[model samples]
Target: MNIRNLAATFVIALFGFFTLNLGLDYGLRNTVPHVLQRRLLNRVTADVVAIGNSVIASGFDVAAFDRASGMHSINAGLGAAEFAQQYVAWKLVTNERTDIKQVVFGTFDYSVTNTKPTKWTTWHSNNALPFYADPSWSIRYGCASRADEVVYLLARRVPLFTERGGLWTKVETLRRYLGGVGFPAAQINRFGRISDSKLLLEQNTEVFERLGRSIVETRVPLVDPVADLLKEAQQKGIASFMVLMPLPADRRSFYAMPGWKAYVVYLRELLSQTGTRLIEATEWSDSREDFADFVHLSEIGAAKFSTRLSEAMQCAK
Candidate 1:
């Protein structure tokens, strides 16, 4: 074939490929995560919107929160989410609705302030970025290290490599619809808190030391974006609270690292300065039976912790 004909054919093929991928993304995005989230939000009409990584998603039970506080709640939790993704999810929810009276932001060792930008981008950028239109410099720079995600997605047309990729994501969504998964009351209750005292102490000692070292090595800066979002929520008349959810006893030690206590102190100061409420549920020193893992809670643990949390919020008022 002549050069002109070959060029024309290549252009046509490229157009077809781009069109096919765009169509797939459009369909899957709307059908999978977006649709599931929309349904949950619709049913919620929640006064308290719980936002965080899987810890919040799996740990906080909407039914328990409602029973405890008489406040309808929605758990907008994603596992392994960084501050950038949390910020994106928060922005998306708040932008679309105005009824959320409070937002509970969960903190962990792997959040934006503690991990590198590249790490943040790799794990959180794709699932989180769709919420904003032309994200600001802060968002861009915070995710600057994640340029590889862009390259990977563009080249491979895949974001996550789990069995639930592309169309398979819809299967997970359908399973949730059929009550196969999402937030199971049984799993929540089963894994909400730790029950073994000896295990708790033994685990925490090792976990805390490693956690401290991770913080020092990464030099993870404090994530100002979360605080800024809380401030915005307050200005809009929405109350916001920062909660350091209980990790398994061993996991809580990470906060005891050399500068860990100082970090929490700084966060508390920031919350105070911003007029946001801070709930320190990290005081698991005496509680051995309330955790399931270093970071997750068993059902009994969730119940106990939720009760304490509800009482604290009430007393604060």
Candidate 2:
């Protein structure tokens, strides 16, 4: 063959190889976002759907809530998700399913603000074409629209950015699963007895003060399209509520910036204007040890907190 014909043949082969690899990657990683997992909770149907970031994702157990309240529930939490991304996800789900009688949004300081957009990783988009169609949002424009796409596409060919944390967590999860232990039990038990609660509280207060400063500087407006959606839901006889997930005890002092108290008061007042109830899980004193991080729940903490949430919901009803 001539050189041109030879080069053409090599190019065609390379294209075929990439297409096949991307297909495999999508198959392995793509699953519904945890927030959308409400479809599988039970045959009984849920009266409520909870949505938020990692705190809501790792901290709330829908199955336990369902059993405790006799109300089917689904936790649609996303990890590391900012409000803009979350708003898109919520819009997509509610647009498709109208039966979701209520939505419980786990509000947090960061959830109300915007952040620099992150690049779209293959793990997040799952090789889905539609994921790239909308590029107007500030976060999408910042992260996905840069030359990073070329880097991501090339990295996929080499498995250079494979999810190490997810893989390790999955293995740990499987070990627990095979041993017939329930979720988060091992992590919770690792802490042992809980006497020095005040020590952790002091630490948390510092963290909260720092977080509060960020909130004030960004002035990122609270993103609650849910008020409009709730109006539609109420017209159709549905209900909605917003819950502010608790922080570690020391978060308040650690993160106590100038506007922190005012911000909290603002959130409460905003919820009232929309006629949606607010549940402050942070008000409970015994709730701090359940956290896996400063903000997320260890599995044991999630179960305990979910039970408390169920009880609170019942009282609200």
* Candidate of highest lDDT: 1
TM-scores for every candidate against the unseen true structure: 0.67, 0.62
> What TM-score number comes out for model 1?
0.67
User: What is the clash count for each candidate, in the order shown?
Assistant: 22, 22
| lDDT of the candidates, in the order given | 0.60, 0.56
Model 2 spans > 4 angstroms off:
1-3, 6-10, 25-44, 115-220, 224-238, 252-258, 285-289, 314-317
C-alpha RMSD of each candidate structure in angstroms:
7.5, 7.9
Query: 1-317, model 1: which lDDT tens digit per residue?
Result: 99999999999998886677666555556532355356554554668888877667666777777798988877777655556666666766776687888888876543435534433333322243433223542345344446744643343333232112445545755764688445543333322223322332324545556665555555544566676678788788887787887765545445566656755665666677667787878764346666555566666776776667777778765
- lDDT of candidate 2 over 1-317, digit per residue (tens): 99999999999998887676665446444334422433333224457777776667777798888878787776666655545445444554455566677777786554544344444453442122214223332234224545775554555343214322234455766775788455354333223223332233334545556666656555555553344444545565556677777776655543345656756665666666556677877644345567765556678788877888888877876
> Which candidate's TM-score is highest?
1
Residue 306, candidate 1: Cα error in Å is 2.5
Query: What is the lDDT, from 0 to 100, of the residue 89 in candidate 1?
Result: 66
